[model samples]
Target: DIAHQNKREIYNLLMRASADAVIRIAADPKHLGARVGVTSVLHTWGSAMTHHPHVHMIVPGGGLSEDGTKWIACRKNFFLSVRVLSRLYRRLILDGLSRLHKAGKLRFFGDHAKLADLAVFDAFLQPLRKIDWVVYAKEPFAGPKAVLAYLSRYTHRVAISNSRLIRVDDRGVTFRVKDYRITGPGRHTTMTLKTDEFIRRFLIHVLPKGQHRIRHYGFFGNGNRTANIARIRELLGAETPVPGLAHDNTIEDADAPARVLALPCPCCGGRLIIVDTFAPAQHPRAPPASARAAA
Candidate 1:
């Protein structure tokens, strides 16, 4: 509830702090005074449908020079150093939180009500400065289509998807969950919870009304994005291509074979043919085709 109430400020701080870190790092003379752009999306749920807030930032591999005369590209397989990013992000966020607390812009209730006291709030944030905050960066997308696909999957997703729901009855709601602790076939499992409990979990993701989850920064920001992009493309000596789907099919084809390997029995190392498909809330029982097939 507190998170939902303060969603706007939290999201804004996250976006600003992260973008500032990138901009500061890129502007260093060693990086050739490059100006980078970032697009960030706020995600508030984990894989098991729990409240875990994080931001996913999509950044171009490099940036244009400060004078907009040359393009500065990052070295192969690396963006900014994660260590540097993490330290800067941690400091920036903690500082912002402190200022907000001092200004009485933050609200605290329930167990955190004690944080309303200035001293307690300062103490609470003091330890955070010594800890390393997580700031992850992934490999660049294959093309614009991959970027589109990623945005589609992540931007507006709720806590749980309809396909994962198995059943809803008086007893509870059952759903399939991926147990990430175990690898391979053993990872899939089912969990059931009361209807009210299910709703409670889902509602944890409800953002504050009118809060914008997607934000753009640097050259992609709203203020002068048009002029900035034009300058960048001109510097790179390339015009913006027509907006269309990426023609590369190799990215999609790479994952196609996983379906064929799905039915392997982990214990017996044998194939398990589907005898019957179970409806929602019911688990499928597929016996191995050959008993004791493994040596």
Candidate 2:
């Protein structure tokens, strides 16, 4: 409910706190003690289309020294402490929320009517400080292909994908969802929700107009990214990339036919089958055999 009323403010708070915490912790002598940069993307929906807002950041394994003389790499196979990040993130966000309330930028409605009072709001944030905010860091990508695959799956994903939708009938809307609490074969499951409830949950993630979901900070910031990357390459004595040529994992053949990613089906968890292919703006001659049989 709070997120619904203050979507823009809440998202902005998330971005600011995440970037700030990473930069601050990395600069500490106990940590990396260098100036680092990160690219952050905001995702507002969980697998079930719930309003679970969080930022996904991609940080280089190392950073430039404070004096900008050389690059400083983190210890192999590890990064900064997640505990330090969680605590600092909590403080920064709570502080931002207080400022918003004091500035009258935040709105309270429904059962939260009492939050308009300063004392009530302060009490509301009290419990949050004690609880550990989740700050996870996954293992580094295996290679460029893995990095590209991760970005392709998540960066622009919506609240839900049509491929996950199984059926819509008198039973309401049915879709596949991952139950993270469970493990092994029983983890994947299907859920059915009333039509109105499904729509309501989906709508909860729509952002306010003009809000940017992706952001970059520090050395990779928009104003100076090119210059910084060039300088870093020079310092490392690496060969410069060819001008106007973007690096990618695919074979460098412009005439080769494009192929779709082999993603598995959500319903049966089976590998994708290529029945047919079509060009841009052109429709397939007919439905696939399986879809035709299903219909």
Top candidate (lDDT):
2
lDDT by residue (102-190, candidate 2, tens digit) is: 99999999899899999999999999989989799998889766776676666667789899999999979999999888989998999
- Residue-level lDDT for 250 in candidate 2: 27
Task: Count clashing residue pairs per candidate.
Answer: 0, 0
- What's each prediction's TM-score? 0.77, 0.83
Distance from true location, Cα of 111 in model 2, Å: 0.3
Candidate 2 accuracy as lDDT: 0.86
lDDT of each: 0.78, 0.86
Which predicted model would earn the best TM-score? 2
Error of 1 at 205 (Å): 1.4
TM-score: model 1 vs. ground truth: 0.77
